[model samples]
Target: MSKLVSENISTLRPYEPGKPIDELERELGISNSIKLASNENPLGPSPKAVEAMQSLLAEAHMYPDGAAFRLREAVSKKFDIPMNEIITGNGSNELLTLAARTFACPGENAVISDYGFVAYKIVLTAANVPFTSVPVQPGFEQDLNALAAACDQNTKLLFLANPNNPTGTYVGRKALENFLKEVPPHVIVVLDEAYVEYADADDYTSGLELRGLRERLLVFRTFSKCYGLGGMRVGFGVGPTELIDYMNRIREPFNVNILAQAAGAAALFDQDFVERTVKANAESMVLFKRALEDMELKYTPSQTNFLLVEMPEADKPLGGAVYQAMLRHGVITRPMAGYGLPNHLRITLGTPAQMERCVGALKAALEEVQ
Candidate 1:
């Protein structure tokens, strides 16, 4: 079996997702556990999307529209981009891998931020494309200068996670513009904006705004985060027509299910629902930050709907212990050891009730660990 597997795939470690609520409850023999690990919308799916999915239940037996025609049109109208520039996927995760598969080769390399989304490294490694990880700057933000310096003629893809996961930090518009200018024309730049809808920073720029600036620029968006459609597994990529065409050619037929397409298209039109989610997240973020401050704990200021909290130093590493303590108390948060931040935890902001529960659990967990 080892001999049958490619060396790259054989050595690769699979991604570790956040523990599901049911699985954690079963393990601990507990009920009503709240999950703030994966950055999912706590308000649940949009009402419009739900109605659309319900309407499509009778049509589940039919195959999905391979081109995602209605969804693509919806996205185009919303973003003001041409329909040909869009390519839908099972999720943005698949599109990220598809981009690498379409553009990079074994000997060529890709550039990614050290603390960027873990999926980028996984996809590149699985495809046998070596990748250079540019170390993050102060405050856990992506080092655009370092990324530009790391790329050379052999670099094929560059993955930048704006409002990066685990850290929840982002780059400003001017910095991104300058960085784009420095990047060579041959290198494809991928902006993973899964959490863009929640960003409230004055300087944050959506890669969608830079569509014609660089022919190789690919912006990935998802229905998973702000749109509350993670279970549906639908996302899309916006890039030049040629790049989108290449990705579409290699993508699996009916990659996105009929329900996902219907839900995603409906979600796109439900701007009011999205606005409510974002507004709720903003209020919750403030609550979490204030609670952390009151407890004398440190955290990164975030543009997205999550925070990266640093646990107090103890006799040993506190992140894992704190995470375990929180889990035992029916609250689930992500320990950042896998992202090389053993002292930190990534917590997704939920509703006010959920946030209050999480903060209470955190205080209790700290007391126990300390």
Candidate 2:
């Protein structure tokens, strides 16, 4: 069986997502566990989106529109992009992999940040394309200079996660623009903006705004983070018409479901819901940072909905122990050992009440672990 597997596939390590609430509850025989692991919208789905999905439940017998026409049109109007340049996916994750598969050839390479989204490496590897991991600079920021230097003639694709995950850092407009100018024209750049909705930085630039600056740029967005539609698994990408057409050629028919299409379109129209979600996340993030300050815990200041907290040094590695302690107290967080930060934990900011509870649990967990 091992011999039958391709070297790339055989050596690959799958991504480990945050633990689900139900799974943690079952494992600990606990009730009412608060999960602030995966960065999710604490406000839940928009009422309009819920209504739209519910209305479509009766149409389950029919297959989804293969092209996601309505959703694409809504996205085009919302973002001011042409419909032909947009493509939908099961999630932004799918589109990322699709880009790798469509562009990367065997023995070629892609460029990604060392601590960027883990899924990029997985997808590139699965496509049998080797990739270079550019080390992050101070404060966990993507080293755009190193990334540009790493690319050569063999580089086919580049994946950049603005307001990158786990570390939650971002690149400013000038830096990104300068970097883009240096990248080879033949290399396709995929800007993964899954958490862009939650980012409030004044200088942060959405790749969509810079699409015209580069011919080979693709911007990916997802409803999973700020829209509270993780369960629906719907995301969209905007790129050159030719690149989008190539991705569509390889896309599975009905890749997005009927309910997802309806909900996504409704979600886009419900600006009030998105505003409220953003407001709540902004307030909760402040509260979490203050709590960490009071606890004398150092953490990465983030523009996204999560914080990467550095645990105090103890006799042993405390990340896993602190995580277990939080779990026992009915609070779930993501340990960052897999990202090579064994002493750090990544925690999602939840609603106000949930944040309070999480702080309390963290306080208790820290005492126990110490």
Off by over 4 Å in 1: none
**lDDT (tens digit, per residue) of candidate 1 on 1-370:** 4488888998998999999999999999999999999899999999999999999999988999999999999999998989999999999999998998999976799999988899998999888899999998788878899999999989999999898887899998999888888899899999999999988889999988776577789999999999999999999999999999999889999899999999999999998999999999999998999999999999998888899999998777799999999999999999999989888999999999999999999999999988
Every model's TM-score: 0.98, 0.98
List where candidate 2 sits over 4 angstroms from the true fold. none
Q: In candidate 2, what residue range of length 10 has the lowest lDDT sum?
A: 1-10
Candidate 2 lDDT (Cα, 0 to 1) = 0.92
- Candidate 2 lDDT for residue 208: 85
Clashes of each: 0, 0
Q: Please provide, for model 2 over 58-107, each residue's C-alpha lDDT reduced to its tens digit, 9 standing for 90 to 100.
A: 99999999999999999999999999999999999999989988988776
